[model samples]
Target: MARSTYVSEFHFSREVRRLSGESPAALRRRIMLERAAWRLQRGEAVATVAADEGWSSAEVFSRAFRRSFGIPPSRVGAEFRLPAPNGLHFHPPHSLWLDGNTASADIPALMIAHDIADTGYLIGRAAELSNTQWRQPLSPNQVVLDWDGPESSVAAVLCGTVWAKEVWLASIEGRDFPSRAATDPASVDARSLAVHHDDIGAHWSAMVATMTADGRLADTVIDALCDPPESFQLYGIVAHVLTYAAHRRELVRALLSRLDVPTRPGDPLDWMRGN
Candidate 1:
């Protein structure tokens, strides 16, 4: 059937709307226009860009481009670029630029710790949600086996984040996986989750301190998760932890939005750039 119906079936339509303040159709149009603008900036012909983006004609694409970016497609490759509207501005991740000069030895760990703390902050915002909001099913049609409601989804993701870090730490230290937080969302509350977050933060800090003292970031070999257990440098484990933590944080944010809780876009770049 309809695109909206498909999105609603997966329980993501409302979450997408709440996060971006736009319906799916509007968001799709915006993305199409943004891609068209990028193509034009790279000196592609307006007609080609328009057709590739599924616009009816060059004239139609030009009008939408002007409306969205305050300039026609033809002007995009000119000497100066037009400024995007406030909500439309794109921000790249600052953490990607961290390197030998800009970041210290402990920067990777610090960045991951910052994300964990930020996830906790977002979860704390849900403390005031009504009981109905907490208990509401994420999708009206489908039942998630382990997670039945918004709160449990958040709890499960939070638990997953901690477990992921613990797994990495064990690999790095050449030990078995330590005890992890409860994965069942129904068994934990916001207060208990906060304590879990704090404990995870402390464990991360200790691991970073040890790594810093030994200067083994590059030399230590980790038994990474793979078929036959391949060996990888310690830095690989750090990168994996960072990526996994970011993904889980976003899952919790999406669940919160689906519950009708207002959440600002929690991009780590926003936190890093002090926005």
Candidate 2:
């Protein structure tokens, strides 16, 4: 028989504080997961989430769920099998959704538990994916969204800022101007996706190192952080990455939506509102 550990009450409250520091993009991702948890709590079947949530297909939800939670929906419930010891789960009122544990019979507790687990899983996954040296570039799906022109350098700058803003919005909460400019607009090819994803990690690492080593915010926030702004802890770096990833993912959806490609519903304000 599998032994399940009850998440202690003290741990729950403490974890919430850690989660509270997430940037705007992370918060929105959490809100979306909360809705997913609520839907599951209401007994909605995963197969029906597509029709119910306006997604083009259940597969999209599954991908988002995995990306958000680190585990597939089929493996989410209690009594569901777990891989080794690192699977994810969700409990309740947690903002994010996903968790891992032995079988569970408590629906509300499970919902919140899973949310916490999923949040941690997503953060850890990001770190792991970023640290690897795999040569796989960004997904080809993003190629069509590349904008080009003589002013394309300026546009790339803006896009890089958008990427950095997502990092700040999701984790640091304070702005950091860490970004890289793409010179050749034509270089923003299908490979750009890979480059962009790598840049997200590299840029954020640079921001963290710069802030810690020199106590300087990125150039993007030089004006705002001129007064020696408060320093964010290491966890803050993780939060920024999470928020950044969520925002970029949504941006991908938005661009695709404009092109008439199906997209997942996104709520930037949920993060912007600081919820």
Candidate 3:
């Protein structure tokens, strides 16, 4: 290493210790043991793992594994990771998961947030249009959802987009469906949608974040709100909402653009940049 890196052996050793807080040999041994623990959890034979990980014997591997993991190899569970100062974790299939890395945001939460913000922006822009333009049908007898009736106008499409969130949130919150001007596509204005969007967006974001953090996304809920009742997964409901909401936003954008109302293409990348 010293010759390859064009440095003295002593200097190389010192820098390795300073940077990694472990001598080179110690790092290699710890990583090898961590890998062995992972394979053992996958039901690899102890003797095979011992040899594959370069341990001299099964007994030697067992002692080392016990010392590092505080559990016998046979007792290994779901957790294969061991603590390390460098925050490096061996992810399965030869990858590294860096602990404490915050550069990446929770993706599903981000999609939900972007949808909320972009929908709100479009609604606000739609509000500036004349009532005639807002209600003027862009596609006659058009329907986005069979039950929601015709989302053929700016007011209808925009309001329907917001209402999708309102309706699902009601189910998640175990409450009755919301009604009034905000729920009425033809009647709902930008101000109504804006206020309701914030309210629903907060609850929606919180619910998803909580459920995700608690590892409850797979947990099922009895959605009595459905006719005759049905069950839904927490994550499924979120994906459903975001999927259709993306469509509604684009529909609104097209409707608004037809009226010469100013708007963007509603690209999430551009939306992210603006914010």
Candidate 4:
């Protein structure tokens, strides 16, 4: 498959500021919980919570709930934890971190919470680089981009890939995943990074130039980018880049967690701030 130009270079220092004070674990939980809540609010089964929240399994989520809230999820009546139609507003303190946002006075729990918080900070920092202007070179771990060479900074490379995907989506005017046609089957075929750099560099540069002309994207454009069309709009493309940054951030967090990397305590609200 050809490489996609979805994201670009990032300066870690600058990018972190834009996403300051938020943790990935918190954000992930928040998005998932809200999704599940919405489903529940609409008379959906509690199992829908796992599906909407992106839990690996209902058992896993139930365990986590019991550990965090001191009550079996089954016993918690729907009335005590009603889902907001729009979304769940994570309360303060609990909203700060995701690893363990509880206020229980357990020392061991606090230590675990600290660990989750620390790791979350690192993940958030890495994401910030992609979201901001960091001129650092790309690392192999970063997602590959069709436009840039393998030597590009890790942050930039990931951003470029996200940007390209958005461009592809916009070019076809598609919704995101789960939508019947969110992805363009034809566009999924990405070239090897080397082949992509050699073949698509010029096209990538042209797109960047167009984006440069419009700096500070407008909202409509961002919406278009996150959800692309067959044609291009400068603002829309930029929005796609930002949205990709956010999405990639989530992917990175999940990867890190699976790899057993340490994380900081965080709340769902922290990660939801950007979108």
For each of the candidates, the C-alpha root-mean-square deviation to the true structure, in angstroms, is 15.3, 20.2, 9.6, 21.4
| Order of models, best lDDT first | 3, 1, 2, 4
Q: TM per model?
A: 0.50, 0.27, 0.60, 0.23
Those runs of model 1 whose alpha carbons end farther than 4 Å from true positions after fitting are: 1-110, 129-152, 220-227, 272-275
**Tens digit per residue, CA lDDT, model 1, 58-137:** 99988988887787788884322233222542222111111143455457666866777686786586565654554444
Give lDDT tens digits, candidate 3, residues 95-122.
7776775767667977988998888889
Candidate 3 vs. true structure, TM-score: 0.60
lDDT top scorer: 3
Full-model lDDT, candidate 4: 0.42
lDDT by residue for model 2 over 71-182, one digit each (tens)?
A: 7766664322222122232334443234444454434233223322332222222222221211122333333224321121212322443344344534453544443343
Q: Pick the winner on lDDT between candidates 1 and 4.
A: 1
> Candidate 1, 85: how far from true, in Å?
35
Write down the lDDT of every candidate, Cα atoms only. Answer: 0.64, 0.42, 0.82, 0.42
In model 1, the Cα lDDT at residue 108 comes to: 68
Better of 2 and 3 by TM-score: 3
User: 87-167 in candidate 4: lDDT tens per residue?
Assistant: 335442234223443554444223323323333344344443322223343234444344433423433433344345445
Q: Count the backbone clashes (under 3 Å) in each candidate.
A: 0, 34, 0, 58
Name the runs in model 3 displaced over 4 angstroms.
1-103, 224-229
Candidate 2: list runs displaced more than 4 Å. Answer: 1-179, 183-187, 199-225, 263-275
